[model samples]
Target: MSIQDIVFVTGNANKLKEVKMILSSESSKFNLINEPLDLEEIQDVDLKSIAMAKCKQASEILGPNRPVFVEDTALVFDEFNGLPGAYIKWFVKSMGLAKIVQMLDSFDNKDAKAITTIVYADGKGEFHVFQGITEGTIVSSRGPTTFGWDSIFQPKESTNGQTYAEMAKEDKNLISQRGRAFAQLKTFLAAESM
Candidate 1:
């Protein structure tokens, strides 16, 4: 597992940048390079399952002799009982941030968590899933800096009550779900290398 580079099946440059940044900040001897595969998202309430599908597909397409990784994110709402849990991406695309906030107007319990599942698959076809969850509450979209549902999600770890979108990018890195998951992935990679 002393990999110098990995095939990350993603087309999103932002994701690639974040992963690259995370790895660069660490002392580990691994670099995440993009493969740019448009893997289909499978239906599952479990984020891990979705990630596993992506990983498996990426591994299969790239052959089973190489190391690759894929990530899936899900936004779970407490009051909605996770109605739009795994479909948060679709919701964001179809309904936009305003509708998401407005949907919770009547619900007092606005508690929510952003869950990021990062699945690493080597040539062995074994899936290693690292998850990161950040507790936060739904708030009105306040900033135009971040993308997706970030503007309406105020992470509990935020000191200034700013939503993830409102906080500085580097600051969000300290507490964001994707940040934490990749951090765990870093530790896992290091441990496996040993």
Candidate 2:
């Protein structure tokens, strides 16, 4: 199969790094060309719509026939009925981690979900979206605080009770929402080649 170059539109260094780590391997079919575009993210109730819109915008800016993908991650509290679903980034920025945990203290249920939505635009005006959800709970910050929300979410799949920030990058990626979403993307790309 011929190698394909795909543009990944994102300004976030942490996201880019995590994506690279998730997608990197000798047999990978894509050469991810990073173009950090400052595209306006439309506020919407649907997280997939936000990624789709961003992917289309990136395709328009990059011109026709260039495959491009954009990703959006959300933290949804089950009790809040997905409050701050697409607005998670802003919430984290304004309230900080400590306050976010405090906000959930009033509720007995701390159940939350981590979601990653990835949209790919084929540059022919066709867009495809892939999503991955990790069932988790919001906990007090318990690990490295550098990465966004990693320290606060404990995936139910974790037997050791380690947060994403506490686990090794490889271990985290194996079960992370982004990792699962990218796995679908990789599968799609592989099938596209055949």
Candidate that scores best on TM-score: 2
Question: How many collisions per candidate?
Answer: 0, 0
Q: Which stretches of candidate 2 lie over 4 Å from their true place?
A: 26-28
For candidate 2, give the lDDT. Answer: 0.89
List clashing residue pairs in candidate 1. Answer: none
lDDT for model 1, on a 0 to 1 scale? 0.84
Clashes of 1: 0
Poorest lDDT segment (10 consecutive residues) of candidate 2: 22-31
Best by lDDT: 2
Q: Candidate 2 residues 91-132, lDDT tens each?
A: 889999989988899999999999999999876778889999
TM-score of predicted model 1?
Answer: 0.93
lDDT of 1 by residue, 107-148 (tens): 889999998899998667677889999999989888882477
Question: Candidate 1 at residue 19, lDDT?
Answer: 71
